[model samples]
Target chain A: MSAVKQFIPLFDRILVSRAVAAAKTKGGIMLPESSQKKLNEGVVVSCGPGAVDADGDVIPVSVSVGDKVLLPEYGGTKLNLDDEEYLLIRDSEILGKFVKVTSE
Target chain B: MSAVKQFIPLFDRILVSRAVAAAKTKGGIMLPESSQKKLNEGVVVSCGPGAVDADGDVIPVSVSVGDKVLLPEYGGTKLNLDDEEYLLIRDSEILGKFVKVTSE
Candidate 1:
């Protein structure tokens, strides 16, 4: 079974996989894996449909799958699946998303 | 000026006044002021129009003015208005409402 199908988040919850440190920078600067600084970032692995409002309306989540997002230092429930660690957090708890800058 | 008119909570927020200790119980038992037990209770003073949903619909608050409610041990923004202390909290933060029981 696929990892995504193993468990599904509910009610505006999101499953995120923390970003791993890269050995090289985007500018081609080489750095040792141990020397690479870990950032509070993650990619949206899966997300719930959204939370229901008092009027029974579905409030869609702002982030989508494969989106890179910035996470808080704390909060979110940690989960272990297939020996990999992930975080399940509410959509509202997410700080923001990282938008790619394209220079024309 | 009336206390209620002084400040109006907005967006599902409620203004509450903590219940004061009474010298006597509802069962007519007499108790000294110092011996009276304080409870995690409050009376709703004012409520906001309600929070707006994604569709711009207003979700009415569950508790109304003069409604007795159970409060959490902590939370709610404290305010001192005209020498009186009050708590401003979201309606969702309230644990539950105390309904008056009537005997036929």
Candidate 2:
């Protein structure tokens, strides 16, 4: 892991990198690059303490770093850092942590 | 309200309509159409029963239909029905439910 990926998430923010396309369609759509559209699935690089609840208490996010998370395709801000595009999304926005399946 | 918007949610899926652009920048990027990119801030159209938890029980999502939700920009499959693009996102993928504010 690089030093940039070693930072801790703050509040409820999570550091994520878009998963490259597994394969492109025959039509050459190229699965819109991260610059063009929000890509799903990312390896959690960092996480925040938690989100504040209505009671003013901290509600910790369920997932942890190194987990592959699924999220909605429509939210989050796009940002570029170190020439690589990454997304800083809230943990609540994540749908679920995918369990890796190894071929039998 | 349209009849299509009156159906009940099934498992944990929430039907959503993309929130239209609040304001478009002059660059003509057009924020990538719903077909090109996943759009954020959808009005919940329907919901599902809930996700099955480790305990084998249903864990209902927090928000309800009519709720305006924020999502991660990077995840979700694109689909179009009846000539309208809509997102069927898992509630867990939703980041937060926006509380409409009435300014004085």
Residue-pair clashes per prediction, in order, are 0, 8
- What does fnat come to for each candidate? 0.02, 0.00
The candidate that wins on DockQ is 2
Please give the C-alpha DockQ score of model 1. Answer: 0.02
Candidate 2 residues A25-57, lDDT tens each? Answer: 668656545545444667877678876665566
Error of 2 at A93 (Å): 1.4
| Candidate 2 DockQ vs. native | 0.03
RMSD of each: 15.1, 14.0
TM-score per candidate, in order?
0.45, 0.43
Candidate 2: misplaced stretches above 4 Å?
A1-7, A23-38, A101-104, B1-104
Worst lDDT run of 10 residues, candidate 2 chain B, spans B1-10
Query: Which numbered prediction scores highest in TM-score against the true structure?
Result: 1
* Residue pairs in candidate 1 whose N, alpha carbon or C atoms collide under 3 angstroms: none
Tell me how far the alpha carbon of residue A103 in candidate 1 is from the true structure, in angstroms, after superposition: 2.3
